[model samples]
Target: MFWHRATDYILSSNYMAHRFCYLLQPGLIWTNVVMDSLIAASYLLIFLALFWMSSRLRQVAEINRYVWIFVAFGTFIVACGMTHVMEVITLWWPIYRFSTVVKTICAAASVPTAILFVRIAPALTRNMERFIFMLSTTQQEKDRALTSLIASEKLAVAGRISASIAHEISNPLESVGNVLHLLRTGAGLSPEMQRLVDSAQGEIIRAGDIARSTLSLYRESAAPVEVSLVPLLQSIIDLQAPALVRNNIQIQTRMRATVAIRAYPGELRQVLINLIQNAAAAIGEDGKIFVRVQPRRGGYSITVADNGPGVQPADRTRLFSLFFTTKGEQGTGLGLWLAHSLIEKLGGRIKFRSRTAGEAAIRGTLFNIWLPLGTPPYVPLAPFSSVQAGRRQMQKTASVASR
Candidate 1:
């Protein structure tokens, strides 16, 4: 507003002085030349400023910006025409009526021009805020993508060594199971003894199940499928029913949008399953796990936030890193990593924030995944190059020979 007022005052004063000078002495060629030169220079400067403002307005993609630009340009053109007319009336015609008409038109154009500029002030401020938010979100997405890439690399290594790990642990587990079974079957003559033997057998069976579950990690594979996101999430909640009940973790959601995204259905399921399990585990016996699904800024945002012991700042960077676990012996340290990798492959982003005020209150972790609206590419194909196959073959043989 100050700038608009200043510009209006300067232009109006110059126009009045130039008009008076030309009308009083139209016969003096040198006097008119000097005044016209000054006036033309001033006009050039104003046009330059207007051009700069218009260029800035074009940078913004919003409708408000476009409207403002159009209004400003129209006002500038009207003002320029009025200024030209005033110059012609004072220097050549010496007509009082024409000068007054030009002045009136200039004044009228200045009014809307000033109002339009003021109107966009609030929009400019709002646009700044939106820009900041988008920048933050983009940075967060970048960090999550990096984490996923690291996790994928770790998983690839894990996959390569998985066979050896399974074989090493399997033999001992089998031996232990056999030994436990034999011990349970050993003869005892009392009813109390038989009951104890039956309990021991049950314990052995549970141990075997646990071992098998752990060993099956190497066999995991993901195949792409088109899955309705809503039903899929609901099914995961159902699967974790026992764990959720045991830990008193509540599941709440809404997915009425019903957008089916292309993904490795099993992998996506496993990701949610791991996250849900972690949420419940963190809460222990009496905390809520909030799961929400809704549309956000042209995309879908799914969040699983829990009231539990939040992650420490030191642990944030490595949260999705392989073998990074805080669960002591109860965790494999690969769950979060696997989840992050799978989500990224499905063209979604995963992020979380751990918030805690102080030591006295319960801390909480909020994990959010933003899935871009529309179909995600399923088949990841390598770029074709003439020498790609030859290069790959050479590298393979070189590695083998080195080994």
Candidate 2:
């Protein structure tokens, strides 16, 4: 009896479901099959796209709070795809119960997706705004850095060209100086003409000194040798005479003793020139510069003092820093730095004293240099006698020219 009733109930349920099904004509069945297949394929493509988006979002999930919303969207797309897949399956099999389950899952996924979109919309908008601001700031910084790079490249090129020109000028300057020396010694002239020739010679010598200094900028490191301090300082002063005369600056020298020290001559000359030039630039017209050399314990102390608008205390600290200049655009700011480095290499020290214009009691700058009379690497074959002979020869030439 029980088996017969179960069979009857099954038959009734099947008949009712069949009544709901449309007539399965050949064309209609094929059309439904094709449409369902296409829908499934489209849903698969949508699922793939959503999956890719979700993976990208996952990469930044740690930093982004909106990751969960995107994840929910992907879940909703997957559920939708499953419903289409169920539709394809139901077209062949009567899996109506499974199709209903897939529909329920899709509905569940869509609810959270909608709620999350509503909750996270403002946050996403704020993130977009911040991203735009950061991009703009980054672009501005890149532009500024590019500009600075271009400027630096231009300055470097200019420096190279200047160095090359200075080097080329050095050779010609030496040749001209030699020619002037010959004219001064070989020519016979009246007193006035002789005086003019001497003046020209002096000017030529000064030009030669400038050329040498410029060349030294490009030259390699030179070996230290014994050099007389008195003559070296005098030569620098003579080289600076034209500038001094133009500014009406008077130079006073007091030599307590003549001393020789082991040093790099070019570097020493460069330092002296830089100091004196700085003094000349500092002083006004009719200013006085006092240079004093005195024997110390086992070395010599040379002081270069100038009456000028002195350096402020704040500026003294950075005086030896490269490219840090008090004279804007006009100064290279390398003189004091180079001098300090060269002085240190020669086992010497440099110091300074100054009082600005605000200090009415005293207002000037003084640079003190101390160099030890270290053991000479090698004795010069000819000593002070060679210098004396050169002076005698010059006097004789002048007298002969006068006669």
Candidate 3:
């Protein structure tokens, strides 16, 4: 009967609460006003100091593993501090109502922070193990290792620090996606609005994939993913459909592959996007671009061709070389190089053929990427001392070349 009464009270559009509850003894809520106010002030000062220190660390990009934990602790201090202030304010006014919202926000931030700290504990342990092992090595090895780390310090810091906070970005993205889903399914919507919602959902999926891929890059796990190139390529095309249409670029796809391959989807996606975008750029307007995926003996060949002015003969040889770009001021040159490097890492290679207007009647460029079926994942190499060098090294080298 009690449970039935509670349910009925909630289901009948009755959401307002009677009054706020107090934990102190009866009539003793404001008996010690002076002491409570002073204690509240001290706690508020502590919260401010903690926040200042944490923010300073964040500004300098030195957000170590414990930096967030300290910030969570600061939130706890604020909640407790605000409660004290509310308790004193409650005696004379209803300012405690505002404090309740602050307390709720603090709880929300702290709970997730605690869960993330627990999740990253294993990583923290492994890092400590690596550091101790590094300490035990010879002075020469230590010097070399330190030199290498310093050489890539920018990368080391980003890979080490950003990976931790990356999930925070993902959480908000998921929340946004969920909100969009609710809006999509809500009543009284038009067809055009529905299309916009569908497009938004696709973008959310792309963002989530990129975030997960970046996190995996930091982990450096060499496990090959089972990926179907057909749908995957189609999705990439869909993601870029608007831009392609806006540029007056006619895009066509021929899917002949009906199987999945063991490959890194993120790398594959990046490669396809690069080739497609490059094609789009090559043909500024009113040009045709074709993407073909077909099965071969042991692998699949993906071809991205554009009926744009082809590669100049002089620049053909350096196409896959590092930092080589034709766009000059507009190009960082890493697109093709990154495509080449990722294809190589996926246990495959990239080949291309181009004919300029002087060489052929139909001047165009074609990039062919060959990826083997079920290529077994290989162990990561280049271990300096104990820790293995990861994609960060490649990333840093790219940065150096760009500079």
Candidate 4:
């Protein structure tokens, strides 16, 4: 009873008027002020650093996905900082009641921070392990993974924008075609003029085909379709002709698969287009690209071959790995990776062979994509044994040279 009364008396308003006396306690007073002030400042800086980190995380979609968790932890940090501020303020003012309240808030905030940390600890550990494993890989592997992650996001948005671009290109191209038509059908024309007009008309039609098919390149349909390889491959050829001509390269395309295949046209277009573009880049100058579509047992074989300086033997192993580019800064190294991924996803496979420069009389590269007999349009195929097991089987059973 005596101790309780004494505690109440010490905390009472009448006995709490010690601000001046406390200040007079020279060494202790300054020590408390300086140490508490520094601590408060440190907490404030920590809070600012966390805020800046959150802002940066917002710019990267993959990293920003878990932003709210960090934000909650930041709130706990700020709450702790507020308690330190209250410590500095209460030294002179002696507002123990308010100071106690700030401490209570800090404790409350820490609870959620602790819970969140526990909840995410396993995920954090797994990611850290993955990161360490990635670090152990060759720099090229790391670069490919990081660049592909960033590029994947950009490509998602670009798909929509490309559809609009294809529309706009078609509109102006049609207008120009009308003017050319008027010029062609006009009365008096020399033989040279007649030939030139006919060529221009053919070029305009090719451009129109390119624009229409380009819509398929980006505006992919959810369901597969009966896609004719002839028009599809021809459109791809027409699309790339301008670039090939600029490099003094000739592209020869043959279509022996007269029947249509059950497939997603956009995916096939993207894969074929990437192959052709890669072929163009491979054969830098004065070369030939032969694209052939032939019937295979269950599906069709689409092959893109070039007579350029073939890929180095050292690079052949990592050719389909994401971001493995022979073009250096000019390549995203994503083409073959996407091609391989899409082929697998479509129940198909890709194989390639290359003879480096001077390795043969005609050094070149050939990429062959073999597809399975696909399901009907809008039909879903059976899943492999398991996602992980399927992937493991693919890695173990498949080979770059496997038929």
**Best model number under lDDT:** 4
* Candidates in descending TM-score order: 4, 3, 2, 1
lDDT of 4 by residue, 113-138 (tens): 89888998899789878877777776
Which 10 consecutive residues of model 1 have the lowest summed lDDT?
379-388
Alpha-carbon deviation at 353 in model 2, angstroms: 1.4
Model 4 compared with the native: what TM-score?
A: 0.53
Q: Residue 255 error for model 4, in Å?
A: 3.4
How would you encode candidate 3's per-residue C-alpha lDDT over 292-366 as one tens digit per residue?
999987999999999999999999999976557899899866678767867887888899999999999989999
Q: How many residue pairs clash (N, CA or C atoms closer than 3 angstroms) in each of the candidate models, in the order given?
A: 0, 0, 0, 0
How far is 279's C-alpha from truth in model 3 (Å)? 1.0
* Candidate 2 lDDT tens digits, 1-403: 9989755553332322321354656676667667767876786777678667766777685445666665677778778878867665565565566567779999999997898798878978888889899999999899867865664456445544545576678788778778767777775777887788788877777666676655553342334567898888887897788879998999999977566788767667878888998888889588999999999989999899999999988898999865678877879776787688668767788999899878767789999998888953433232334434555798999999999
Model with the higher TM-score, candidate 1 or 2:
2
* Alpha carbon lDDT of each predicted model: 0.68, 0.74, 0.75, 0.78
Per-residue lDDT tens digits for candidate 1, residues 146-249, read: 87677666765664354346546667767776875776677663778667767766666655544444334333333444667788778678657767887666
RMSD of each: 14.8, 15.3, 30.3, 16.2
Q: Which portions of model 3 miss their true places by more than 4 Å?
A: 1-169, 180-221, 380-403
lDDT of 2 at 36: 67
Model 1: residues with Cα > 4 Å off, grouped in runs: 1-224, 357-362, 377-403
